[model samples]
Target: MTLTDRLVRWRYRLVPDHVLGELLSKRWMDNAIPLIILVAVAAVFGSLIPGFYGPQSLSDLARQWGEFALIVLALTIVMAAGGIDLSVGSTFALGNIVALALIGVAGLPVWAVVVLTMACGAAVGLVNGLLVGYLRLRAFLTTLVTLIIVRAVVDMLLLRYAVAIAASFPDSDLWFWFGDGFVAGIPVSVVVAVAVALILHLVLSRTRPGWQVLAVGGSRRSAHNVGIPVRRVICMTYVVSGTLAAGAGVLFASRLGAAGSDIGLGLEIAALTAAVLGGNSLGGGRSSAAKAVIGSLIVMILVNGLVRLGVTSGANSLLLGLVLLIAVAIDVRWLKNRNKVLAKVYVSPTYADLPPAPGTDDGSPYALNDRLRPVEAIGLGEIDGPEDVILDEDDNIYVGNRTGDIVRFLAPDYSRHEVFAHVGGRPLGMALARDGALLVCIGGMGLYRIGQDRTVERLTDETNRSLFSIIDDSRLRLADDLDIAPDGRVFFSEATVRYEMHEWPVDCLESRGNGRIICYDPNSRTTRTVLRNLVFPNGICMTHDGQSFLFAETWACRVSRYWFDGPRKGQVEPIIPDLPGYPDNINRASDGTYWLALVGMRTPAFDLALRMPGFRRRMARRVAPDEWMFPNINTGCVLRFDETGRVIETFWDRKGDNHPMITSMREHKGHLYIGGISNNRIGRLKLEGADPGWTGWQSYWGRA
Candidate 1:
């Protein structure tokens, strides 16, 4: 390989994947980058320009910052709610004109004038809201039209009465103080702007209205389905936008002692630029008001510095336009390739090469066999990716589907099926509680309970996060498979904390210890980590004697035993090592043994890739997701193991015609029901010698 390849390989060996993944996945990283840029810009200008950091320049900046900053805050709220108000500049100018007219000609009190001016602005906002929210008009187009109409009306009013208003109100100390007064060295307008920004920040981050706004922005259909008043939320955002813009206008007019037609010109572009620079998404949902303020400060500083340098207004506009374009391009590209970028930065673990697989000869345990009888396909096209299968006391088969549903197949012929529960997340492993309640591990959501009445309740979704972790580790990301202990404790395995459920292949490539085994006590309603730092822990099963449990670590291709009562209690020991294929779920066999399902067999190419950590990391970043080397899950086998962990017998669909990628198998009433992660329907095999009445429930809980 080239020198660059060699250097990357050496670097990969020096760092761990989990550590790198944790650093890249931090939430603060988004805001931190822009904050750093702001600081750098400020420092460069402060050192290069004379009087840039002086008190006089700072005070003037504070006073001027309020006008545009308020407008920026207005745009931020609307943007967060998945809408934009292009009419803000026009509303600001109109507010100025109305304030002048009411005070100069109408001879109204300052307080009454302020209220009337604000009311007019609110009226314009109400119209915009009605069009966008209730009338279903496009926000951008509707607001653009409003901008034209409001500007036109403001121009007409100015043409008719501007000279009279200007002559009537030549001096008003009270009004000027609203813009020029200072408290604790901060201008009154600056204080108002800061307070408003703070309040908006709190509302968006902590209040119900803010959540409703974000929810609507995130997905309007979803918000409506969840019973949120989508229209009302959208309407309220525009109202806030117009009111804030109007307040900015009053401040601007007061500071200048005149209401000019061009006073609010180009203010919209500045506000939008500031919001975008602060990391506010144009597509909406994920933004903060605090970011807008910081963005506004950056814009103000840049403009002030440019003016000090005697840059032409045209050049200033060009520079601002370039900044906006570059910032947006960077933000969009980073968001699109965030996962790939993260993969490039991290070092995945490398594994020892896989040994040669045993031939499928007559003497081999995995020899070609047709002992697994084919059954009619049930829910053939209806179910998707039944990763794990279970049965209720009445022999009703329950399968977890890829579309976040738990489907139940009726007994006898297993023809009739219906959706049992909609978990809203990919459901993986499932178990039957002693009380007949169903416990399910929803991939991204966490552990949940489904009662017979069809009520779904979340059991637990958090564990004690590692103190050293920068990201919040409390939330489970990929809860894979679960099994219950006799003493009312529920045990489950989180496949990979570093990646989500859909990114299982990426986790395999990483081959790092990002998985953990957790136990939840129903009596105490507590969940705690029992074992940690496992490599893609997949399936879990409690031992028959209630003394230990078997957990399959997929990437490691090994099964481990954790004892609860024996001398090895609190310690883990390998039960089976160096498996030919990656194991998935473990189920109790009827004859006092266990059945282990191998999801995929390791291939030579994947084995070599595992040994080269740097190669895998590069592949993850450069290769398309579908083209990435994944575990060979197209062919698998189920092996029966004795209590001593010795292989008893193996059953395989050698050609993978009837069933492939067998992830889980459970014996009930002499029929072995098999499930696969990518199969449309489950497979059933008849075991002639096995007890026809034996069930997995009896194997665990015994006959009542």
Candidate 2:
């Protein structure tokens, strides 16, 4: 390749083709947000202060952050491993005492004392590791217990040696060098902090052990099943944790010129807050130590600068409290919180109605009808994330609940009735397989084919086996819906793994559309991507023509058609754009037509908000669940069209009587069966004399 070509390739490669866009659009990167904030702060201060640009203040600032930075680095690893260590402060004090005891009491050499202190730290970490890793103890509770015990032990040891250290006289220069020495204009402490960070980054990004640690943190069960030796990695994190805390202790002593009983007090929260603020997950396995270090530095700078600005100690405490709140807000629980962030902001609400199938639409070219209505209130009794729905040959209804399970209703009457499958993890879409079996696209768990006997079997789980062994999360995210070809080739969507179904808002807020259309061949028993790098591929529908299919790209609010055979083989083209609502499921109309369900209506506000990634992410991460600030597809509705890309008729569920968030509605046996991922009842209504042909086909071929 030429230089220019290579450069172009490199740029494209780094550009998160699909997932990266989703991540970037949502401001999902740990560094993305913090980096911006840091730059803004630095710019403001550097411009505001007369001597702010001077090297002296910068150097002092760098040096001043060593303690917190190192501590944060340790906490970053802990959080990344999916846990916390509230006992770090006690461990820090323990390290100082051990170093002092080794040098002054044991008369050990300087280098030996350093090694011994680190070993002592490892031993302390071992205890914590054993408790947390082997015993499977809650990290918070174990660390809390360890903190108290370790502090008590340190206090007792200090009282025993207080007089001896004082009388022994001049003490050791070794402790001072390890703590407060300078090397090439940078303090040894700062150098150590940087080195630790570099080492951590390498472990996290390049090493197998680091990968295991992350896997363990993110999902411990997943790491164990994948043969990652999770316990060993978890225990070792504590070892590293203790070592860093001890090292920080040495730095503390050198900085302070002496060790005391109250050494390294109350620093755990600072480290955790730093790690979280730096963009690491408290939910484990998603962390960056480097980001944590920078976060630590930011915290230190804020604290020091605030103090310098004559801020009261009380105000400083409040600032710390606020920083902690922000850090906590970055959690997965916070991210998945649907009630807080309105739908349209996190997940795009605007989806254009696909061109009507041949003869049913408004007789116009493909586009949303100008008559689209916006509603101020929906009368549907509490509905949640409606992913997809299914209907039986009898026209009985079934809705897949994103947060819960399936719901079914009686035919034509819309009387709520049953739940055929209670399988958990966001259930997206469902369809009746040819064999009289109900198949569901269970998000996180895989594509489940449930038999009439209610026997749930996972027919397709590994999507190309890309991360089979490294499946940190066992749930299947085979998104919104699926369509089976006549030959039983199941085409499904694998949406962004970066965000879970409930947490899909994060993906939207981050805008990293790492999505793909996967084809699962039943005969070959293989799942492969038909198209990769899509913006958040949602629903799938196969045409009775057997030549092409349609699917939704939710975040982009577009519906597209993909040709499976003939002249345009493997080609994809946009069928509709600028949808009025977030499109969910697409089903064939019984009367040689097609139906597209509108889950929510999109607004103009969302399009402009996409440009402001930071604001979007903040809204997702920090806003109230039901706050009107977030945009949502205004109301639930469905659209019908003939096969030739024409506008048919639009059927709306303005009262949510048919179901709010109309994820699915399949025409079967002269009745329209409506299902939703989060609807309380599947709805059924007759289309009067409509028959998609198969009247006697099911009985003739035995449920064909």
- Give the number of the best model, judged by lDDT: 1
Give TM-scores for every candidate, taking all chains together and pairing residue i with residue i.
Answer: 0.77, 0.50
What are the per-residue Cα lDDT tens digits for candidate 2 across 629-695? Answer: 4447446677886655564678664555335556666666765656555564445566656865443
How much is 436 displaced in model 1, in angstroms? Answer: 1.8
**Top candidate when judged by TM-score against the true structure:** 1
lDDT of each: 0.84, 0.68
lDDT of 1: 0.84
Superpose all Cα atoms of candidate 1 onto the true structure and report the RMSD in Å to 1 decimal.
5.6
Tally clashing residue pairs in candidate 1: 0
Q: What C-alpha lDDT does candidate 2 achieve relative to the native structure? A: 0.68
